[model samples]
Target chain A: MSFSPLIQQLITSLRCLPGVGPKSAQRMAFHLLERDPDGALALAEALQKSVSEIGHCKLCRTLSETEICDICSATDRDSSVLCILESPIDVLAVEQTGGFNGLYFVLSGHLSPIDGIGPEDLGIDKLLERVQSSDIKELILATNPTVEGEATAHYIAAQVKDLGVKVSRIAHGVPVGGELEFVDGGTLAHALAGRRSLL
Target chain B: MSFSPLIQQLITSLRCLPGVGPKSAQRMAFHLLERDPDGALALAEALQKSVSEIGHCKLCRTLSETEICDICSATDRDSSVLCILESPIDVLAVEQTGGFNGLYFVLSGHLSPIDGIGPEDLGIDKLLERVQSSDIKELILATNPTVEGEATAHYIAAQVKDLGVKVSRIAHGVPVGGELEFVDGGTLAHALAGRRSLL
Candidate 1:
């Protein structure tokens, strides 16, 4: 009365995706088996190749197939400025903006003592080493605005304080398209506290 | 400024699943790469094995690793009553209800002339052959109540009218737990028309 063994296994395996549940997994398995076998095969091959071949870039800790990512290796990028982020996806988000020609350092995750995540888990030592060794002049802490992210940024800033590099945090305020009425209290407070004097 | 080639390929490939868009695909690719490499590898293996090995059952056309599906091959299931459905997922739905022990015939898709699908494409000839050769006493068309499904059920019923087997379509009415005020007009009408008398 249940699916065949292979079908069942396929459905179970599909549930590893972030938001997929049992029903979605079942639908995905059936969709692959019935409608798009070629796509299913291609996806399988792509997953196998990506998981086995992709690794963290030695320079930035962002996902890369090579030891150094394209941004780190590019001659046109500004190595003197380093932007620190919490995850690899943040690197993509920043790059999509068409601004900020600086180098990047991915922390992989923020500090969370409850989850047992510490400075060493985020490779802060390696980031400090990179900062000390390179000619980086400015460091921008671009981690998320969450409590853990702010703590992580502050910890890294404290570590690099005596390293002679100019350290700064990314601006926190209302988003460009957001209405003031809908903005959260914490964001409004930050925006007011960090307000600049116009010339 | 984009992801590495393999990462990009994996994200693009992940979009092949139903309802997954660019952002979801990217999230899935990164999630598998960062959080669950073992799951990623396992999913790849499962997809490869399922797609390459699973084929339609010889007797029922439902996806199966073996020549015949479990339901069709079981000796306990009734061969004298058949339930015809539009897809393999319907078989799973019916089986989950635990109400009937009749065998199933999967049409893979409903008849759609606009999309160029027809009776031959749904293997109507094979279905007729099975009905004529088997000792089946009755057939229950359990296709969806949509336009195409109704047309398909009607077409199939007409084809098997002269075969001396009793043919019936599953009822169309409001769902058991649905509120009467919220139910659509067509469904409400069907519910009223099909109302039973207990006197």
Candidate 2:
């Protein structure tokens, strides 16, 4: 009944993924060894390569292979406007829409004191340095709508207010395809208060 | 918005896992590269090593690092009793129960004509060879209760009937925690048909 120690090790290693459990890890290990070893090899090499090569951008703190990220280094992007987000994934989310052509400053994570994460842990001082030193006119807070995200945003806003940078937040409202009846009270209230007038 | 090609490749390769999608892959890639590079490297090495080293057993067709699986090569297990199952995972399931001390033959998959799988696809001939060459007293069909599994079990039974081998199918019944009302009619029927006196 017991699998070989190596097979057991492979299964345990796969459990490092976000949502994977023991059963899923076992399935993944079996799949990698059985069905597509080449694909599995690619994933293996990719994991090592990405981990070795990828690092946080000096300016934005987003994932990059070099010292600076593409978005941070791009000449066309508006450096005068910066978008703040909880993670690099949010940067990708905003970038995919082509709606924001501004530079970004990734917090890397929200301020969660329970997890020993705070403003300092999120590198908020580095963000303040960018605002104080640059001609940045707008700092858009695009962190998640969770309590920690809101607290982090408020903290950042207060820190940058003296620098004369106009701080804004991405709107919180009912999702476009969501029904109002299913929407939570907090979201509905934000939607009502942040309502826009039609031209 | 597009990640580096290495990151992209990692994400794409992660999708090869069962139930993994674009979003989870991205999350996994980020978690590996960002949070735990050492653990990521271990996983990478494990994946490569397992894929390269692991192979099917010559006799039982279960995962092993050699020409034959440990279970098939073991002398302590009963050689006269053979259990046929649809996958190596099923072998683990049976072995874990501490019930079966017999030898095993893993089909790897069941008969699925729609997917171009047949008796040959499952290497039924190899199983037949084992049956013909060994002093097998009993053959237990432990395939799933699905239509394809049933068909596969029937096909196996027909192929071995003339060999004087006593073939038996694993019982079908309601799951342990399943409510009687919620149990499928087929399972309920099987339960009724297989009922024995509890004396």
Candidate 3:
């Protein structure tokens, strides 16, 4: 016999997660029901609160509860230099490096014409407006090094080039602590083409 | 800098699901917030409803929203044969096979004294009472083939052998369609030991 209605519903709804399939959904549903009901309740509350309350930052378009994100509104960060990324999670990745102290602009996604995604869909106009209206001197393109990301970066560079803002793309190379022998061909080629002289 | 408080809480809460780590949790959180907020809300409601309403079946102790599970209450199912398992998930596995039409008894866990789990904790007394009070003629032990499961099955068999009920453990051997050369040594031994001759 099939599971009771509520248990079946729980398993079905859990399949909406990115990587969860029927088997994983069943495991997760039973795990929550039998071993950790409190955790299930807490996760439910967290999902409800975050989905209903979180919104995009007005200045950066990053996920935020307030009008402006903490990184954008912080006084210690440099607003003159902006790092443009494909999604809010990328913002966290750059922040974790403890290197960038500048403001950020999240595009939410890259240019994907086949999927009907355009510059307007990703708020490119808003990004251009922010750069033109503010005292920003440099714009860093930190989108993923994929076809769509490269196209999106180039398009944005052309848009802001005439506006007198210095535009730069993040370097593509073999990752630190990685051996050259194991590096992918495309990345190695990019590293060779973009190498700088130590002298 | 860390994510905004709400985003951070959502990521942390998502980690409560099995096999979800920090990276997967973050990806799931952003995926829900950006692309599928409606799915997130639905999942939250399902989790809340299932965790609060689902309880153990009165007869079989499998997870059920009703007092008696469908399998236990069905008139067509055989009451003379029972399958003893370690968890509710096993019931679903057996049902999917469509080979057995008997009731089930869920132990929730096998005996483990070091973890402070014993027969009483697993409701072994209740299992005995049900077998004695009902017309059950045979019991099939379908717990995992681990050490603890073997011990649990043997203990239950000893308890019920004197009550005039036939008791048996599921066989452990090379699975159907699996190559004999690829089978493990332990399973090969079991297969040879349990081999039956065809007259």
lDDT per residue (tens digit) for residues A1-199 in model 2 = 6798889999999988889999999888887776778888888888878887888899999888889888888899888899999998888889899998999999979988899987888999999888888899999999999998998999888888788879999999999999999999999999999999998
DockQ of each: 0.90, 0.73, 0.89
Question: Per-residue lDDT tens digits of candidate 1, residues A1-199?
Answer: 6789999999999999999999999999999999999999999999999999999999999999999889989999888999999999999999999889999999979999999999999999999999989899999999999999999999998999899999999999999999999999999999999999998
Cα distance off (Å), candidate 3, residue B40? 0.6
Query: Quick one: best DockQ, which candidate?
Result: 1
lDDT of 1 by residue, B1-199 (tens): 6788899999999999998999999999989998899999999999999999999999999999999988998999889999999999999999999998999999979999999999999988899999999899999999999999999999999999999999999988889888989999999899899988999
Which window of 10 residues has the lowest lDDT sum in candidate 2 chain B? B1-10
RMSD of 3: 1.2
Pairs of residues at least 3 apart in sequence or in different chains that clash in candidate 3:
none
The iRMS of the candidates, in order, is: 0.8, 1.2, 0.8
Candidate 2 docking band? medium
* Candidate 3 runs further than 4 Å off: none
- Model 1, TM vs. native: 0.98
Better DockQ candidate (2, 3): 3
Model 3, B69-120: lDDT tens digits are: 8898899989999999999999999999999998899997899989999899
* Stretches > 4 Å off in candidate 1: none
User: lDDT of all predictions, in order shown?
Assistant: 0.94, 0.89, 0.94
lDDT per residue, candidate 2, B20-92, as tens digits? 9889999988888778788899998999899888889989898888888889888899999999998888888
